[model samples]
Target: MARNRYSFLVKLPTAIALIAAADQLFLGTAIGSWIGALALGWILALLLSRPALRRRPSLVALAVAAGFTGVLAHAPSLLGWVLFWSALSIAALMPRIGRFDDAWRWGLRLLAHAMTGPLAPLLDGIRLFRARPRRGRPSSSGLAALLVLPLAMTGLFLALFASANPLIARGLTQVSLPSSFSVIFWALVLLVVWPSLRPTRWATRIVARMPSADIELPGLPQATLLLSLILFNAVFALQNGLDLAFLWSGAALPEGVTLADYAHRGAYPLIATALLAGLFVLVALKPGSASAANPAIRRLVVLWVAQNLLLVASSILRTLDYVEAYSLTGFRIAALAWMGLVAIGLVLICWRMLAGRSAAWLINANALMAALALGAASVVDLDASAAAWNVRHAREVGGRGVELDLCYLSWTGPSSLLSLIELERRPLPPRFRDRVRYVRAEVLETLVRRQADWRSWTWRNQRRLDTARRLLGANPPAPAATWPGTHRECDGWIRDDPAPEPAPSVTSESDPVANAVATTTPPLTGTPSR
Candidate 1:
C-alpha cells in the first residue's frame, strides 16, 4: 500500500512537467513530430513510476516502436495516435498480466484499464489522504495561519504601491498572464497522462466480474435452426442473385434506377445485413452445441455463410462502382476496408463453427485482423491518396474520371500538395489551368508557412516541399488575390457576380481574367450565372 502511494507521489511532478512540455509543443502549432516527443515523454514518465516495467524489455521496446511511429510518417495519422496510446496502456498493465491469462480476458482487462486510467490519480489521492496518520497536528490550518499574515501584508503593500507609483500601476496593467484555456489544457493533459503514469491495478476485477466465457446459453432447437438457416439462405440468395444480374453481369437496371443509386443504397445496408447475420449465427449456433453439431443445420449454415460472403463481395463491387461513377474520398476507402473486415469476420465465424472453436477464439481472430488493418492504415495517407487519385483520373486532364474537385482538395490542405502539383503539370484548358494554379498556390502557401515553424515541421511536409520546389521551382505561384471560398469556387472559377464591393475599373485587354478579382469574372465550363 505504501509503495503504491509513493509511486503516485513520485510521478506527480513528472506528469506536471510533461504537461508543461505538451503546452509548449502543441498549443500554438499544428501537430507534427512533437507528438512523437510527447509520446516518448509519457512512456518515460510511466517507466519512472513503475520500475518493474523496465524488466519487461520486449514490451518496452514495442511501446517505443509504436510511439515513435507517430513521427515516422510525414504527418501523424489517427492510426498512429490510437497505436501510441494503446501501446502505453498495454505497457502500463504488463506487470498485472498473470501466467494463466487468456488473450480475450486479458484484452478485456486492458480495455478496463483504459476506461479507468484517467480516474486513477484522483482515486489514489483519496486513498493516500485517508491512509495518513490521525495523530499529526492539523497541518492545513497551521499552514494557513503561517501564510495568511504574509499574504495579507503583501497584498496591502502591493495595492498601496500600485496607487502611489505610476510605474508600478502601468507594470501591473501590462502583465500578460496565461489565458483560461491554459488551465483547461493543463487539466486535459493531466487526464491523458495520469493513467499511463499510474495504472489502476484493480481493473482486473472488471474482467473477473464478467460472466465466464465458457458459460453456454441454450442453443436453438435443431429443427427450428435448420429451418431458419434454409429461409435465410433463400432470402440472401435472392439479393445475391439480383446483385449478380445487375451489378456483376451488367444487366440493365429498371428505367428509373441508375447504377449509382443502386450501388450507393446497397453498399452500407448490405454490410449491416452481413453483420447482423454474423451475430445471429454466433448467438444461435454454438460450436459444440446440438444445433451446430447436426449435419443438416451444419450444411445449411455453411450455405448461408457462403451466401453472406457473396453478399459482401457484391457490396465491395458496388462501393468500387460508386467510386468510379463519382469520386473517391477517405470515407469511401474506409468503407471498402470495412467491407473487407466484414468479409473476413464472416469467414472467421464459419471457420470457428466448423472447427468447434470458442467465442473467445473467434473474437481474438477478428481483433487480430482489425489490428493488422488499422496498423496498415496508420502509415498510409488516405486523404493524399484520394487527392492524387482524383487528380490523375480527372476529366480536365482528358482522363475518364470526373472533373477535378478543387474544393475538396482545398479542404484536404497540404495533403493535396503533390496532387495539385501534378495537376499543374498536366495539359489543361487556359481558364481551367488558371483556376488550377490559383487553388494550388493557396494550398502550397499554407503548407510552406506551416512548415516554417519548428513545432509544425514533419518529414512528410518537408519531402513534399522539396519535391514541389524541384517541380515548380523556388518561386511559388503568386498568392491568389481571392481565396477559393471568398470570390472563387474551389475549382478556381470566378463567381458569376463579384462581392457587393465595386470591382476596380482598370482592366487589361490582354488578360481580362488575370486580375479577376479587380474586374469581371472569368468564363469557365461550369460557372453558373445569376
Candidate 2:
C-alpha cells in the first residue's frame, strides 16, 4: 500500500507571518498584546483545521510552525518560553510517534488533507510571484477592495449612528474619520506591488506521503430537555401576552395598564415555576430508552433533582423577601404561594428518588411536575402583583394618578418584575389564588416612589410616603444602586436625611468565642486582630 504526504509549511508559516506583521504594523509591539493575538490566531487555525490535522503529520508541522511564528513575530518576548516548552513536548511525543502503527500514520495523513484549504491559496501566490518578473504589473483591484471594506463598514456605522441618535452626534464628529478612497487606493497599490507566494505545490508533495485510517464509536442519546424547556417558556410568554391584551380591554382597570406589566415584574417566580414544571414532565416522560442502571441516567437524575431543589429554594427565598427582595405590593403573596407549590413538587421528587422504583417513570413525572409548578407559579404571581399594585398606586395618588402609573408600568417593559406584579388580581383564575399579604421593604419603597410621582400626587397621602422616606434615608442606599434613571431619581426624592455613622471594628469581651476561648488555652492562630 502507498502512503500520502501533506505539506503544511506554506500555510502555517504564512498565517503566522501575516498575523505578526499585522500586529506589529497596527497594534504596536507590546509583548502581552502580541502574545494574546498569536494565541488567538493559533486557536482559530487549529479550530479551522481540526478535521484535516487528525490525519497528517506534515500538516500538523505546518500548523505548529504557523502557530510558533505567530507567537514569535507578534510577541518576541514569549519566544524563549515557547521554545523551551516546544522542545520538551516534542521530546515527550517522540516515543509515541516512533511507536505509532500504519493505522495511526494513515489517520495523520487524513488530517493533513483536511487542513489543505487555508494553506493552498497562499502557496499558489508564492509560486506565482517566484516565477513572475519583478517589474511586471499585477491586478490591484482585489487587494484594494479588501482593505476598503472595514473602513467602509465603520463609516456607514458612524453615519447611521449620527442620523438616528442626536445624542451621539457631537461625539461622532469629534473622532477622526478614515478616508475610504485612500484606504482602497493603498490596498490596490499593495496588491500590485506585493510578491505572490504559493504553498499548494509544497502541500501537495507533503500530503502525498501521508497514510489513512478508520475509527468508530457507539451511539449515545442526546438530551433534548433543555430545548423543550426553552420552547415551553416561549409559548407561555406568548400566551401571557394575549391574555393581558384581552384583560386590558375592560374599562375597570387602570387605563393603558395591561397584564404584561404584572408579568414582567414577577419574572423570577414565573421562570422558577416553569422550570419546576418542565423537570416534572421530563421525569415523567423519561424520553430516552436508556435504563436506570446506566451511570449516565443516574448522574442526570441526580443533576435534575439538585437543580430543581436549588431553584425551589431560591424561589422560596425570593418570595419570602430574601434574594431579589422587592416590596410586597402586588403578587408578592402569590409568589409565596407559587413557592409553596414548588416546595411540594420538590418533596414529591425526593419521594420518587428515595423509593428507588420505576426510576424512568419517576423521572418523567418529576419533569411534568416541575413544568406545571413553574408555569402556575409564574402566571399566578404576574396576575396578583399587577392587579394589587395598579389599584393601590392609583388610589394612593388620587384618580388623576392612573395615566402616569400606566406609563410607569409600561416603562418596566417585558421583564420578570412586571410578571410578578400581575399575579394578584381578583376573580382569581381557577386553581389560582387572588390575594397575598407579605411585602418586602424594597417593594414598599418602589410603591411609595410611584405614589409620590403620581400626576395627582398630593401631601394628603404622605403617611406611607413619609415612612418610606425615613427608612431609605436611614439606610442611605449603598453606593452601588441597582435601578438607575427614573428609579434613582425617585429614590432621591423619597429618601430621608442621612444618618451619622457608627464606630468601626470594636469587639466586645462578652462575645461567645471570645469569652469561652479566652478562659481556656490560647487559640490555634493567635489573638484576633483588634
Candidate 3:
C-alpha cells in the first residue's frame, strides 16, 4: 500500500507538467502559469490523498498552508497554480469530509476532465461579459446597476467640472480608465460565477429559450464575428474619446493639437457616418410581401437608392466642410456598393419567398452580404481611427530611432500600431524582429515572474501616470515630422518626376483594378470581389 501510494504521488506532478505543456502550446504562457498553479494543487491533493494525512487536523492545515505557500513561492504562477491546487484540494477534501455525494464528486471529476477544452469558450464568454455587460442577463444587471450610480455621478461631476473650466474638462478627458474596463469586466466575473447561481429547471428552460435558434439564427461563427466587430468598434471609439464635442464658436485652437481633439471636434459627423452605414445595411436587407407582386420590393429598392443618394450627399457635404475627411474612400465605397448588391439580393430573396423560388440562394446571399457589410464596417472604422495615440507614440518612438529591447509586447499597444497605415508599413530594425515594444521588457518579465506584481507596480504606476496626465491636461505627444512625411506623395518625389497636376483626392471612387474585375465576373454574383 505504501509503494502504490508512493507511485501515485510520483506520477501526479509529471501528469500535471504534461498538462501544463499542452496548455502552453495551445492556450499560451498565461495558461501555462495557471497549469503550474494547478500542478501545485495536484501535488497538495496527492499529499492529502493519504488517509493518515486526511485524518490529522494538523496535516490538513499544513497542506492548506503549503498550497498557499507554493502559490506565493511561484509568485508568477499564482493564478494558474493556485486554481489548479484549489480545484484538486477541493476534489480530495470533498470525499474526505463526506460533504459531497459520490454523484457530485463524479460530476466534478467529469468537469475537470473536460476543463481544458471548455476553457477557451469559458474565457471567451468572460471576455464578452467584460466588454458589454448590458447585453447579458440579470446576474450582470445587478452589477451594472451598482456601477451605474457611481459612473453617473462621476460623469455628472466631470461634466460640471468641464463646463465650469474647459481646461479641466480637457484634462479630465485624458484620465486613463481602469486597466480592467468596467462594464465588460463585471460581466466576465458574473459569467464565471454564473453556473453556481444557475436557476432551477423552469427558470432554466425560460432563459434557455430566450436565446433560441431563430433569434441567434446566424449561428456561432457569425455571432462571434458580430461580437468581435461590435467590441472592436466600441473599444476604438472609447479609446479615442470620440464623443467629446468642444464649442467651436471660433475659439483659437492650440498649436500641435492631437488627433483626439480633431476626433472630438468631428464626433457628430463620424457618428452620423456610422449611423448612415448601418441604415444602408438595414435598407439593403428589407423584406417583401407575396400579395404585392413585387411592388413592395420595387418600392423598397427605390427607397434604398434614395437613401443612399442622401447619405452620399451628406457625406460629400461633411467632407467639404472639413467636419470629416473623405477618408471614406476605398472600403467605404465598397461597403456602399455591397449594400446596393444586398438590396438587390433582398429583392431576389423576397421574390423567392413570394414566388416559391429557392430559399437556399436567398439565405446564402443574405448571409454573404451580412458578412461583407460586417467585415467592411469593421475594417473601415478600425482603419479610420487606427492611428490613435498609443500606436502613434510607439511609431514616433521607433521612427525617432529608439531601440526596442523587449521580448513580448503589450497586446493593446501593438494592436494599436497595426491599426495605422504608416506605422504598419514602416519597417522596424531587424534587431527587434518578433519583439514588440509596448510595455518595457522589465515590466513584462516581472509580471511573468511575479504575476501579482503587475497589480502592485506596472499597472498601478501606469494608472497613476494616466490619471495625473489627465488631471494636468497633458496632450498626447506629436507625430514625428518623418512619420507624416512617410504618408506624403511618394510618386512626386521621384528624381525624374513629371510636372505635377492637381492630384486627385485619395477618396475618389475610381479604382481601375476593381472595375476590371467587376466586368469579368458573372453578373449572378454581382462582382468578383463580392
Best-matching candidate per TM-score: 1
The clash count of every prediction, one per candidate, is 1, 105, 9
TM-scores for all candidates: the values are: 0.84, 0.20, 0.24
Worst ten in a row by lDDT for model 3? 485-494
Question: Ranking under lDDT, best-scoring first?
Answer: 1, 2, 3
Cα lDDT for residue 470, candidate 1: 92
Highest-lDDT candidate: 1
lDDT of 3: 0.39
TM-score of 1: 0.84
Error of 2 at 228 (Å): 13
Better of 2 and 3 by TM-score: 3
For candidate 3, write residues 1-530 as lDDT tens digits. 33433444454444444444443332312332243344444344445444443545435544554554444333323332334344443434343343422333333443543343224335434443444323343433366677999999998988888989989978987997744444354434333322211111222223323332122122223334344445544554452332223222334446887544543344345435544444433333333323223454344434443343343433333333332232222334444455355345535544544455433445455555654554344333232232342234442344332222121123222222333223323575532321332222223334335334332323322433444335324443222222322331211111333466897654435787776676687666555562
